[model samples]
Target: MEGISTLLSYILPGHSRSVTADYQFLQQSWLPTMHFQASLPRLPVPKLEDTCKKYLTTQKTILSPEEFQQTARNVDEFQLKEGPQLHQKLIEIDAENKHTSYISEPWFDMYLSDRRPLPINFNPYMIFYQEKNAAYNSPLVKATNIVISSARFLRALRAGLLEPQIFHMNKKKSDTKLFRVVTRILPSRIATYGAYLFKAFPLDMSQFENLFGTTRIPEIGKDRITKDPNARHVLVMRRGYFYTFDILNEDGSIRSPHEIASCINSILNDPREPNLCPIGILTTTERNQWAQNRRHLVDIGNADVFRKIDTATFLLILDDDLVSEDFPVLVRHFLHSDGCNRWFDKSFSLIITGKGWSGINFEHSWGDGVAVLRFCQDMKIDVSMRPHFHPEEQAHLPSSSPDVEKLDFKIDDVVMESVNRALKEYKHWTLERLTTKHLLHNIFNKKQCKNAGVSPDAIMQLSFQLALYKLEKRAVATYESCSTSAFKHGRTETVRSFTEQTKALCKAIVERGTSNVNNKEYKKMMIECSKTHAMLTKEAAMGQGFDRHLFMLKRIWQKYYDGEPPAIFKDPAFTKLNENILSTSTLNASVVMGGGFGPVVEHGYGIGYMIDDTDLSIRLAVASYKHNRDASEYIASLISAFEDIERILLSE
Candidate 1:
């Protein structure tokens, strides 16, 4: 009967658990200190002719003269015939929905429908190097400190007390012309403008464990994510064991850092069996498979329990300490979910090691890296500000504590078979298929590029072009993410990184070695490439990018035109130009926060880079399914290319 009850606990979907806080307290706490969404401007649709012209101009650099002419003809016909009608339709839709751009729904749909597994494909982790002091390195100390800091950040977020981020253009170093006036006109605008910080919870806990009960359960297919409306606990995983404890007092105030530290100490001292179910591994599987498995599990017994476990406020993992602070070692355990740690389905998972270094792996579907980065920065600042927790302090703590549930699963032979299968698949996807490279180059950084009459973005991009050309022997259509957060609910636009100037620069590097590449012609071409990149970046930032406009137009065509695909859509050049062979983003992380993500396309490389005073650091990822996609070789080329570019500029 006890085993059956435990089995029933694992499969349930919903629970009748209620937690209460003072209504007046919550009402007063919901103060809007940061009105991130107030008076935010909506994205304006781009002019059809201008978009068409820019599209042709960008393609000229990538395609051959003959190919360019064919594309040019296609563009002209599209502009004259279908483009006008599509533009009108978009305008109508934009007018009808004044709150968001016509393309916003499509963009949102595109992201949600991607259906990629989280680990190496979508969810990216931010790595934080630990402080030198050894006293704050204990697992319990780090865990409790992190919880207190994180809880504070969460409370701040809920109350809108966290100051909204604002971006202003620089006069001395503007990416576009009229930057001085633009800076004055724009003032301080919120990012993802008009978009509030969304709080997504993954589910409920046992009735006895109300406030501190959040569960992360694995089903057959897409694991369940649910949260009780009033729960104030965090889920913690360490050594394949899960523990939940309340961080909030009954009156709704957050517990003191010391109190949280005591709870962590108590948790660490408690003996627990290894996770027999290891249900979190199911999250690492493909969504469809997981969803199917979930249905099977629910049918077995506790449907309500499974649903409750699905919705937790957030997830926290206390990982094992590593001796060396290598990227590979950190990243391996940071993202690994086979059996050791984590239910990867949460909106964000904060991973802290016993060594004190920490990082985050988050589901990309919830929000972009920028939003999460802000949250991370807040946590880092909070943690650094707080004093260290001493182990001796555990003696002077509360005697009676909130109950921490050790969730047990009744696993039959069938379930064990499924677990083994998931383990095999997850191992291949993470350990075998995905390859990561973190390069810390001691080359010229932002300052050097500025001195060389180029934007840092342009130089970084040009280096990638050169590297790709070296590896693949030709240019590939590159998609660089440009934030459109200047406008309300603005997400990202594709800044077509490949250009005629980039091709020219690549050609110069290939034809002339680094020592002899300092000619006036080559220098001119390099600067031009940088200028072109800068212009596109500025345009994209202003919500006037080419790709999103074209994407919306194509969707409109599909919606209105009740016939076969148009000539523009069928053009081989059109298909070839949009293939994202090199998907990259300049995350531009600060010293406090660093983010890394996987490739969008299977055969392409996902590159996240950051530039500092005298250094350039990059995290490169490629799918290992393709035997030929050598990320290490590409990194080598990237290093060589950047070195050559630096040498060429300094040679004269």
Candidate 2:
């Protein structure tokens, strides 16, 4: 060790240094000597650096600032000029294939849940299933390559579906990415057995109630209702954006809560008249109630019901009218089917929630079985981003219907009924839930999380803590017991770009997470915020946090739920969000924090996640008086389960 090479000193000095005399003894005692005699003291060391430089042409080629600038400019011009031309031909070819001359029909091939063994797995259980399947009859379902594409993109999407052979390959391939519709593939495989393609069922608006049945939301035991502080619900926006239902006076404050109530009432009176109005008047009783409760959460007594609607999450544009409420079947189809590559919960914000709307008690369906509750959330707004079911559109409902089995209600039926209700909520919740902040931290990171032994995630345990924490929070209700999303993969058609506007506030909150703020890093962040502000002010047509898609969402929400409408929940503005076009994960970390929620944790976007957190000794809590006890118990159950697993290891 004493004869080690000189490089070892710089690489691993492993010494302590002290600026004061307080620790001089320890520092001096441990440090190596400044001078040391070599084992071969008589030998002369070879000058390696000088010899290499002398043998080579010792010339240095360094680009200066001006040279760098000129080089960058030339490169930029080359790319800009050639990029479009290279892509134009492909774009033109695709556009030319459009069915402009053909007559179009609204008939859609609805995919019933399809089951297929895939190369993908979410939980350890799925991995176990894969091992078991390797021994089962997985003939064509084996590692056979298949090619499926959107009807519109038929040309560019062929050459793969050659033949189904005897191949057992679960090896995930990049080529297979385009075929995997994220939500559709995963949810259907887990929920239903295989893929099903059914024709659209036509519905006559006048006789709509007959095709699909309806039922009242049954009650549960009073003691079953939870009041846990950590109870929560999250609305991660998969797509589009959010907007406020009401606007404020020039002075900048809501007149009163009654204004909201009045607006809700007005919208119900006529929900269909699409004018440039706000988004409160067109909601149903359930939505109106939830809106009122939300107002209370945001400084309840200060403004009229409709006077000042919180428009913080307003302004969204959309690719299609898939955000409407009338297209339930289509919206949920791709949500749970592999028709789109998205995490189920991430694709649709109709996630499970322990936190009720703002303050009122309700359920969620996006992830939970709280169909009715999440439905109430969606009913409160106008979602033009989805397909709206008007009388004319209803005519396209399948002229013929499938025979849906009807089973009598039993005690066990309660769970199924809850499931159906949650499904209904999902139709609308998927879209509405996205634009709004999820019910995630409304309670999880609130004061109550401190008391319930809840806590934020540490660096390593971030995702585990986030999902598990949220799970426990919403597990208070039996219906909203459990549900989750999938992580993204580097599929052939992986999500490339995502908007950061949704999470700006959350980042601001994180910037304040630590106590010390007098650092250079903090100053740099301030400069960034200033830049964001400057960019926002330039785009006056769009407000701050104005993503075009999100802004469009805001406008639709304002018109449907905030202002007057032709019909509402009572009047019949109720509809579905994505019927078949499932959206997927689009949360910006910042939005997760600032939407008036709390301490940001993690969502397993691409990590192998497990909810294993110790040191829950830190009791975090949220305060919501009227809470669901069952949901609370479930949240407790999930948290305790993870804790127990960890505790068992500790005991061992």
Candidate 3:
């Protein structure tokens, strides 16, 4: 068996030999960078009393007095009796695991295994518009520039030339260094591999000659990725056809933009048959479903083609031309509703449309938006500095006509049926699940927030809550993501946006319209809300949020305690308030690259807002099922709420 395993390792791309070598190389290369990962404090088990107190306070507004009293009793009993013992056990567990975060393992497991539909549920997008010098209509020119820039940035990252992300303390004088948790590798057939190998950005200058393009191939239910380590080409998807073209010079340096443009022109102009079944649509299926289908596909010869596609540097999507500046058309390409223009499983894919407007759709599993934003900013700067070529420049460029390889799968009757099903399901899912709205508010910008004596974030958070109240006529459970990346492998903590002050302000604004609003009282209320918002946000950032702490405690009780479930855990009031109706986050990125995700629950809205000095942009997603709620109408209500609040503040 060992001998067979060894023989198979020699044949497979990321098999036993590669995994062993990769692990050894990873240990040596990452040892220097793991100091912070090692030195970071363990996720602290906060005093059960404090956590219970905070939990009770969060429930006060949502629960009736009698209901609150019952929850209070349950919390008191748990804290006084079993909580201390559980805390001790959790401390012991933390002490036992010294290398990684206690929450880190479970967090990742939950993220990957949740099996939600990707289009709007878990995946987020960032769209970059075509600037004066940045826009390139030709796929070859755009893809080459993006690939080269990405390679340089990634190499700099591995070489430690780029600055590590430091935690910016809100009030403290000094910035604290955080764990650099970004990984550029995307997962492929996670269940089959049980682990993924991180691809090292080409290090040696000459090594770059053998590398060119990488791609992800979608199977019936699951998807596999491949790359050609010895090939210097990139995968291009246009009008539902796939082709590969080289992007590197013989010596490994990237070819000139003009040369790449010529290669792309030849391929696009040359006639090629479209795919029999748009297999890329299967990437749109749920993870486990895809995995099951992938098992069946292995019997076919799709594995080798997939391996070649996944080995490329990255996937570059060349969309059909869009001459109009209509925001909807640009969004259709970026978000990619039904077209076969995207392979969504890649860690990151650069999408260049016909109008030269481009953006990125990235898998959230690899890294957060911060790292991707930095890369986007670098690309923007690089494009700005690049010299544009004239029409005559193409004639003078080097003529290296590399054979553009065409990679395709053999779609039998079984595979063809799956493909059709996927296309129909994905098309309907997009029409129902993904919706976009842009708000450019002249009055509710950063300056307006300051003049109104409130933090911009707090104002926006309150506005979302207020809009929900107006629309639903009740306070809804809301979530605001607070980054805890200050700690090792830290991701996020949930900050409850529904506060006492928010509740009061919403009621007041509803009763007294903008005409009869009280400026002094409203200003005073908003100021208090701002302070409360800041305090909760600070606690969340400090790893003292209510959700994770309670989650761990419940898990501990289930593991160690032999008694029945705690009343607090089974209480209806607690369960009701815990249902997240509005999953919101303030992800501040360049306006062009800012994007959002779908709400976690079916009847909820995912709100990603960016508040600039002069304007505010919101990316909203909601399930368009049965007209439960309309995202556009909600945005209008939010706009009206902002207007009412501003009017009340300035009336005095």
Candidate maximizing lDDT: 1
- For every candidate, C-alpha RMSD to the true structure in Å: 9.7, 33.1, 10.1
TM-score of each: 0.82, 0.19, 0.80
Ranking by TM-score: 1, 3, 2
Lowest summed-lDDT stretch of 10 residues in model 2? 143-152
What is the C-alpha local distance difference test score of candidate 1?
A: 0.64
- Candidate 1 error regions (>4 Å): 1-33, 170-231, 273-276, 302-308, 321-324, 335-340, 387-402, 516-520, 559-561, 592-594, 614-626
What number of backbone clashes does candidate 1 have, counting pairs of residues 3 or more apart or in separate chains? 39
Error of 3 at 396 (Å): 5.3
Please tell me which predicted candidate would have the highest TM-score against the true structure: 1
Query: Between the candidate structures 2 and 3, which one is better when assessed by lDDT?
Result: 3
The lDDT-based order of candidates, best leading, equals 1, 3, 2
| Pick by lDDT: 1 or 2, better one | 1
